[model samples]
Target: MTVFDDGERPRGGGPWPIWGIPLVLSLCGLVMIASLSLRNSMTGGSPYAQIVKQCVFFLSGLVLMFACAFSSLRRFRRWSGLLWFIALLLLVGTLIPGLGVRVGGARRWLDLRLMRFQPLEFLLLAVPLFLADRLDRSRREGFQGFLRPTLMVTLLSILPLLFQPNLGGTILVTLICLMMHVENRGWRYPLMGGAFMVVLFVSLVMIEPYRMRRFLAFWDPWSDPMNKGFQIIQGLVAFCNGRLFGVGIGKGLQEDEYLPAAQTDYIFPAIGEEFGLAGTLFLLSLYAVWTIRAYRIYRRCSNPFLSVLTLGLTMSIIGPMFINIGGVTKLMPLTGIPLPFVSAGGSAMLFMWAKVGILMRINKISLGEGRREREPEGC
Candidate 1:
């Protein structure tokens, strides 16, 4: 029998299960978001307002995803650097006093008339796309050949994220780049990358007082509930309120008044309270299924660009999702990153769905190439 005879046949279209999982997760997230925000919508405006905006972002992301998916990975390789530069421009604009929009204190969003956007969202895609193309291409020369360009590009991508004071995003973006390094150069590069990150994180914590407080709170949040630990305390309260099943959708006490950012960073706690442990577990399982499927896509794709793209996309999805959930549950410190798919943010939803679209498109390539065999050490 041929090598392809092991039930790994070329799919007529893309692998449906890969795309289907995230699509289902997004749909479920939308339903939950609508239900969770129902009271907020009613009190703040119309009951459907948040849902309408989310739908618009979701649809737009779908379009972008498909467009990227069908396009040549070579085309992405050519233009990704330009896209990164554009994102950098937007990031610089965000730092400007009036150009960037400020919600609580961090000026991270740009006021783009119709809607606000966080430039970091674009970096999530652009950086990975560029790195996948460049790193995979560099494998022809040698792993060492990739060192200078990789470091330069990775640093350029990270500087903007760090300056935003978005430690969560910076760590995630760095890891995404490091994943490409692992696929190309192996553990040595990623370990070096990890060591550098440790130093950077140490420096950051030392320089910032609030960051130190968050570290302390991670150790024991209740020590300062009204100050450094208010959010986590409220999150714990929400979890306690959820006994076995849940309080039911739209019936969470956390959203009623107690927890701040209940709809954003603390949304998971609200889910635990309203939907109960069963509901939270159901959602988490979807994410786990999605990650496994994404890695399978990476493993199956023949093209190195497609492989790296899948890995990057997986990190983008899994990293922030786990961190956000962990934070709200007080398993980790409170880092203000949004819950994937479920959080109410236009830029994040649009960018996230667009990446999903790219994954779907790559699956088409994998199927067309016939049952893809395991790629070599260099992605």
Candidate 2:
């Protein structure tokens, strides 16, 4: 088997091989968010509010991405544990009465005065890093040897998310963890863990009447079209209205109070409504190419930690896109997962950009330029 060595440059001797795809996606997101948010902003608010905020986030994310791309992976690994702990603290803090602001009935964001953010966003990167570190240490012990500790850590991290009732975040994190575990420990451990997760997920849904209603709504939304099913119905209508070519950017009707979360969870439908099916496909293709490129870099990585990190980060970005799109199209229950790079959320955008940066760093390392770098002596 061929192994990539430290300090050796990849066959392609440049810094940004697959950055264009994400850049296009991000730009598309900004355009779509601007269009979709117009209606909401017109109602006693500045029309430019959402777009401006997203732009600020986009610029900030760019800075973070570049920092991550050029920073030391070893330094990242060293601080992974502390980051995970801080993430947990924030998650817990979000549940506190004064600290966590309630929106639409869910307490998922910390009130930072200047802005609120979901702590779970940090986990999108932290959990994977923490797991990479743990799994790398236990690579010699086999899956069975590390299974218990893995489960314990996963449960600890996910339990708070469950309390926040962030079904989407919980599901995303669980899936990412499972994928990472399977990659390092093989299929057996995750298969068992997956089964347990299924049972737990079902139980959580069953225990909550609202969740059960959401599940039922997914199966036959027409049953409660005026109430619980309104969002899905509007989403379907948006897609149907944009059958081939989109109605045209800024021309879609559903976003004007007809579709809920038109700028966030259901933004994909907004894109479909305005840009049409062709546009949606174009966006999906971008995602597909971006994910494929990330996987290619992963395949070329010789570092076990980098490989695991890449896989987890790729899934974290792509998984939510699929889930959000599926939910909007009624292919799956609405999980309230924002469409990764496309959604109007600062925290998600920031971390996602950071993940992209990490991928770029890994790509550079794989090429051999950063091969001589090693983890800190004590890390």
Best TM-score among the predictions, by candidate number? 2
lDDT computed for candidate 2: 0.83
The TM-scores of all predictions, comma-separated, are 0.89, 0.93
lDDT of each: 0.75, 0.83
lDDT at 377, model 2 = 32
Which candidate tops lDDT? 2
Give model 1's TM-score versus the native structure. 0.89
* lDDT digits (tens) for residues 301-352 of candidate 1: 6566667777887788788898898888778776788888777778887888
- Summing lDDT over every window of 10 consecutive residues in candidate 1, give the lowest-scoring window: 1-10
Candidate 2 residues 89-155, lDDT tens each? 9999989999999887888999998888889889888998888888777745555544654676688
Alpha carbon lDDT at 40, candidate 1 = 66
